[model samples]
Target: MYSVVFQEICSRYGKTYSWDLKSLVMGKKALEAAQIVIDVLQLPMSKEELVEESQRKLQELFPTAELMPENSPEQEWGDFWAERTGCAVPENEGLELLPEAALGTRDVFKPAAFTLPDDAGRVYSSLPAPLSRSPPHAVQCLVFEDAPNGVEAALTAGMQVVMVPDENLSRDLTTKATVVLSSLQDLQPELFGLPAYE
Candidate 1:
């Protein structure tokens, strides 16, 4: 659907997106991507205007659009991005922490193994009870989520969240995130007091 829309935009502007340029735009923030499209295609529109028009077009097309096909490309990209960042990519699935090999090298090891919202709340409540001086407080931990439910759970636990929602997610829903990003690649660890990439 996005490809179709992008093609239409290109057709209208008499331009084409190369694979390399598309890759650059893939993980950029919405406005950033809009600016790239407008600039690269030399479209006769401001970034804000392009964003508004794109949103309007998307709104009209989304209801009738088919679901995107499932693929491993995005998963591969995520793995590559995480490795490049030197960050452990722990899979925080239901009540489980599927830490990768690199996780063992870390000095601290506290997995956020929560299956449900109630479980998350319990974890948050217990943090200050046993160790008030140490870290892992709700405010100190930042949640990076792609799902709306996960965002809600983290917010409910009083933790700040940086949500990298799928493109199809409603704009209204994205506001629930403390910060919304296009991808993990766009994350600034320094903003959360984590070590920045050199």
Candidate 2:
């Protein structure tokens, strides 16, 4: 979806994006990605305009595009956690889902608040009640984030954050992370006290 819209925009400007550049912007927030594209192309468009145009294009394309995977991998990633970590996941606020579906045999939490500094509890509390048996201390947590805002959120909560940034993101924007990596594939979970991948 984004690639198609971005390619269309780039075509208008006689610009082309490499896959690496596309990967970089893929991790950014919508407007942030749009701004990066605008800067890269030196497009005479505001970030808001770029976002609006992209969204309009997405709306037009999504219904017709062969979007859904015919067969999603049978929960390989989620199941791995389910086996080793008891599978408690967080449900962000404002998304619609039933309580049972939201927090069931599979643990899921929705933070009480999204504010910074004091948000550590919210992050912890988002874990299903049972899995939150450990005391709530930010350092005990490790956050993996892609966007600067998410990094800020984890930092404000006093957790160590591992940033997997878009390759094209500014180096300066990633300095605050405890560590930065090109991809989650490079993550060493044991360094953060999690069980190492098998």
Candidate 3:
């Protein structure tokens, strides 16, 4: 029934959610599509509610769900713009993060995220200032690819590292270079301040 659900979503609100489901457009496009779906479908609900309701109904029909959404911060980025340095946040509030390999750009390893928020808002992906050098630091980038390992190393090296797991996933984390590794075992124990795991 996955096909059925996809078809329904496309046929019913495809034009509306096109920005959200499509792999191309970013920022305001997604926000608009989401808002359109909410309105046309009369889904008068908060961002969280909309996501939850869609998940519930979709699940009722298809036992095997396929949506792999990224992490979303509860922070209210209300009325934000995406023009300046840190304007990559609100526009990307509820965007989805997909797997790479065949879906992402070769310029980056992590999956790419799309959005529909305005072109002049903060999307959380672009942090402001010196901390923005996340991708340059060796251990920082490592922690990004392998968080637990990176975190442990940062701890052992006496280097302070604060991770903002919120707003993480495709665009933001890729920009931050802080995507969390899926399995702890995938990271070396040396990454955890101890000998490599055997």
Candidate 4:
């Protein structure tokens, strides 16, 4: 019974190992079934020191081959889905209930009070940054004007900050954080060795 069950498992998964099947499923009955196949098939080692040792012996006895590469991400998410949308599935913010409700709220407080330095202003990028695969640490500091990001400082130190200009600047400016990329194209994988899709 165990040997027959093992044969069925092997037929379905296209793998040639009791240990792999054992890892996928758990139980003594499954182990017993694998043993039966090992015993009847005269597998090289039913009791090797390690599974790799067992695999080596099995290869010698059976001349192992595979119909497909095991770790192909291509096999996981077909070509179209993999190539489509660069695989950055936009997260649903789940703000449907109060989507625009927060806009006119009284609780969303602005800075209570603040003053800008008379001599303070923002620095300008005379040219755009080119694409590079440098690691994030390569940049001692990053700057952006008003795109959604983290760790921003208000422009108040006499052009000591980097500015990213966009047409969609709101009347009430969030002049705190610095934007990294001037456009979405700047976020390409070729710039980071993580090119979207494959």
Candidate 5:
């Protein structure tokens, strides 16, 4: 969705959106991402203008958006927890912790703070008290991430992260992850001291 909107924006300036640029902006905050795009492409518009135009286009496209096939398990996991807890678990449980919320700003993009390198460790450090009666230390936590930024964030928090990167992502960007796999299906929980899948 972002690529689609970015392509449209870049096309107006006769610039093509490349995956390299996408990688840089992928996990950043909206304004931050917009600034990177503008600076890198040397676009004529300001960050705010780029963001506004992108948002307008996104609103029109989002209605027909479909969930990625790989994300189906996330929904299943939410449903499983909701069933056991007898409380509604939203599919996007961490939405409230997005940078937009933290910065008191609103945007169509919803990158969670946990995906931001500087904020990830801080947010993870604070999760224990509210979420558990006996919270484990940061080192005891295992994170599952699909982006390099997320892997960096979890590592900064002193947690091991299993990265399931997009196939097109550069190999050099994946070296920092404690573990890397092509898909979640390829992950063996037992390897990380967690229970084996049934």
Candidate 6:
């Protein structure tokens, strides 16, 4: 989805979007990514202009894209986690899922009460009573992430992270993850001391 939009943006300026450029921006916030692109490409546009164009292209392209394999429509994510953990994970309680609109592309660039590593701590703090009455130490948390930044955030918060990284990402970038898998389908819960899938 992002690559298509990026390609369109690059083509407009007669610049080809390369894998190297994609890697640099892969896990960055939208504004940060846009700035990087402009600086790297020496594009004749402001970061805001690039971001707006990319967002416009994304909005058009996203509707036609298929859901990621992990986001199967038949299984609600909260329920999936609840079943796997044998614990209640009601939305916004044991688990909080925010839509893209809630965290706007621009919102992440600014300092916030909750961000990245701190957000990981907040999530642990906000776990429902059934999940943890007292704040469970961050060491008790297991995070599943797809980006190097997210893995770093989980580790910074003292949690282990299972990373399912993009195939194009460098192996060196994946070294910090507790475990790395090519896809979510390859995950083995029992390996992490979680119950095996029934």
Winner by TM-score = 5
Order candidates by lDDT, high to low.
Answer: 5, 6, 2, 1, 3, 4
lDDT per model vs. reference = 0.55, 0.58, 0.34, 0.31, 0.61, 0.60
Q: Identify the superior model by TM-score, candidate 1 or candidate 3.
A: 1
Q: What is the Cα-based lDDT of residue 43 in candidate 2? A: 86
Better of 2 and 3 by TM-score: 2
lDDT of 3 at 67: 32
Using lDDT as the measure, which candidate wins? 5
Model 6, 113-145: lDDT tens digits are 222223545432221112232244435667666
- Ranked by TM-score from best down, the candidates are 5, 6, 2, 1, 3, 4
Q: How do all models score by TM-score?
A: 0.38, 0.50, 0.26, 0.18, 0.68, 0.67
Looking at candidate 1, the ten consecutive residues that score lowest on lDDT are 124-133
Candidate 3 displacement at residue 35 in angstroms? 4.5
What is the TM-score of candidate 2?
0.50
User: Compared with the true structure, what per-residue lDDT tens digits does model 2 show for residues 86-155?
Assistant: 3322332212222333334444233422322125343322211212212455346666666565566567
What TM-score number comes out for model 5? 0.68
Per-residue lDDT of model 1, residues 15-134, tens digit only: 775544454454344577778888777888888887676666666665563322334554444445456443222232212221233244332434444322234453332111111223
**RMSD (CA, Å), each prediction:** 14.9, 8.0, 16.1, 25.5, 8.0, 8.5
Query: In candidate 6, which residue pairs get closer than 3 Å at backbone N, Cα or C atoms, i.e. clash?
Result: none
